[model samples]
Target: MLAIGLEGSANKLGVGIIQHPDRSSLEHNKSVTIISNIRHTFHAPPGEGFLPKDTAKHHRTWVALLVAQAMEEAGVTVDDIACICYTKGPGMGAPLTSVAIAARTLATLWGKELVGVNHCVGHIEMGRAITKADNPVVLYVSGGNTQVIAYASQRYRIFGEALDIAVGNCLDRFARTLNIPNDPAPGYNIEQMAKKGRHLVELPYTVKGMDCSFAGILSSIDLHAERLHKDGKRWTDPETQQPITREDLCFSLQETVYAMLVEITERAMAHVGSQQVLIVGGVGSNERLQEMMGHMARDRGGSVFATDERFCIDNGIMIAHAGLLAYKTGFTTKLSDSTVTQRFRTDEVFIKWRD
Candidate 1:
């Protein structure tokens, strides 16, 4: 079956098309046919700090183009698609409404069922599908989230999460302190700086039980930056700085944050009695984090799985795949059931979404 997925929960506006084999799980699992997948994106305001109206407007303006691009890449027309999927909630209301409206309209036109998907579940499912990791602990970190999750009874359970600000939000704030570029993603610039920064400076590291707090860390960093500026010390370019480089800071930040995530993930694994680990979300794309998780998994006689950018970062294919699974299990939302949620807990969804 062909499915078209729309993802506009945050900064990106993506459309994806994927084909699922029409057969039982056993039959489909045994077959190795490469199902086609294609996607396209539109620029959303950087920093993931855009206003709801702006994000929604961007979505309304660009979704059709992205869908068409995905269709072209998939070598199929809109008529070939059998189902339509969209991210439902745990995101900004205006943006979610924009995408949902688009998907609902398309489904109406094509006579297809509109499926609502949890954005986080999409991240995990796509991570699993791409990496083929079975029962792996997931560390989902993004602009608005930082949580340790795992699959249980055919649903994802949140074992640990940030108590305050998200890790990505912390990184973005740090980038702003350094006056880093803000387009595309602030995390990217921070990553680049961390790559060139020297770890001559020590930053606070804090992790409590399975829950972490980034708000304190961000405040501490801000104070430190203020101190540095007051000292009349010249800050050099992260790319060209010598002696102690910005890359060192980048490395330090990546190391500290990723270590926290890895530590929490390990804790979750031990608590859940799961040996395998999987890293999801945009931060999962960081090579340093991947390496740390890999080593941690290996030390425990397990393996760590991470999805490529295709699934690692936010996109539509994952949403479509997750929505497909939900649809197959008779999980449907009535029109009256629609509601946008900014802080919907992953574990809470299991009660209503589990098969």
Candidate 2:
């Protein structure tokens, strides 16, 4: 089965074409081949966040070009496509609409089925496809979402989630406070800084039951950043006696926030009695997070599953794979039902493909 997927729920717009083999060729097992994956990002300047209006414009300007480029790269004709897929929700409204409209246009023009995929489920299915992780606890983290999930009863049930702002949002706002670059991603730049850090500054760690919170941590770190800026950042680290640098703040924030995530994920794993844990979403691309999760999983006698930027960090291939799974299950979004929203929950989608 061949499908084209368009993803633009955030600053990055992606287009991908992928194909799944027929069971007649590969019996008892299935494989997915990514024909093409193209992405275009609309990053804000240092110390700024991307606005919905500007992000929507970016998707509108690049969607057609990206789709054409993906088709060329995939070397596929329009007739070969079985379906058109797009992210449906739990993202910025304007950007989601922009991509959804493009997907609807393509579906209508090609006379193909339209599969509306949940952004979080896209991440989960793509991670599973890449890592071959079967029945693992899922950690879904991104700019707009922070969730710990477990699969049961044809549903990806949420074990825990952010009570306020998501972890990526906290990191991005911290990056803004420090005026760090957002070219690749704010979290990535922070991870780079965290590598050079020796001192761990104390920050609030709020884990309420299974859920976690990051707004307080962001507030605390932002105050520290403000004070350091006022002092020209010449403050001394009490532990190392070395100067407290911005890198230290990044390191501390990562350590604290990641610990909160690990704690909740571990609890979910214990509850679900799953050995493997799969990390998904844009923040799942963080090496630090993967390492920390690996440590926790190992201690529990399990493994941590993660993907690189191509799959983990919000791309079209994931949408294509997940949407195709739904399409194969005889699911298609009607023209009247093809809409985008900012508040679609992860558990809202029924996982009919999974046993």
Candidate 3:
């Protein structure tokens, strides 16, 4: 069976086609084949963040083109698709609604079933499918969400998360403060800069038991940047008294925040008595973060699993994979019930497909 997925939970709008082999052929390792996966992202100016209204407009405009492109790349027609999957929540309302509208339109026009997928669940499912990590502790870190999750009683239970702002949000906002380019991605640019930093500037590290907070760290860093800009003073390393560069700030932020995430994930793993760890979401693509997580897992006599940019960042394939799982389990969303939301929780979904 084939499934087409539309995803625009935030600035990125994606269209993907996936094929699931017949039940008899599912015994092989490659049961699922990705036909086509394409995406278009909306980039705001250096000091600006993408607004929901503008991001929605971008999705609405490019969704049709992307869908057509994906279909062509997949070498399939509308008649081949058995289901249409779209992200249903935990994102900006306007973007989610825009993508949902496109999905509904496609389903109605093609006379196919509609499947609603949770954005976070999509990430987790894709991570598992690609990494072959079975029931590992998952750390999902994105621009909007930061969570450590484990499966229990047919639910992906959240063990820890950010209390105030997400770690990606913290990095993006800090990038804006430094006027970093958002062409590829602010986080990627920050990661590159961090590699060149020699000294780590101390920043506030706030972790409340299991949950962590990044708002204080962002504020403190912003204040220091402002003071340096206003007074024209060169930030110096406390030990060597050498001038500190912007790279140092970016490096410090990544190190501090990623360490906090690794700490909480380790705690969750110890609590759940699990040895394997899976990292998902956009921030999961960071090499430094992955390195840190691998070190932590190795020390615990375990290993870490992660994917590259294709699956780590927001994309349609994850939604398609997850929604198809639900569709196979006799789940479908009626047209009347296919409304988009901005606060859907991961634990809210009943995992009927999992034992």
Worst 10 residues of 2 by lDDT: 21-30
Model 2 alpha-carbon drift over 4 Å, by segment:
23-29, 237-242
Q: What is the per-residue lDDT of model 3 for residues 254-354, given as tens digits with 9 covering 90 to 100?
A: 99999999999999999999999999999999999999999999999999999999999999998998888888878999999999999999999998878
- Best of the two (1, 2) by TM-score: 2
Model 1 residue-pair collision total:
13
What is the clash count for each candidate, in the order shown? 13, 0, 0
lDDT of 2 by residue, 149-188 (tens): 9999999999999999999999999999999999999999
Instruction: Please give each candidate's TM-score.
Output: 0.88, 0.97, 0.97
The runs of at least 3 residues in candidate 3 whose Cα sits more than 4 Å from the true structure, single-residue gaps closed, are 23-30, 231-233, 237-240
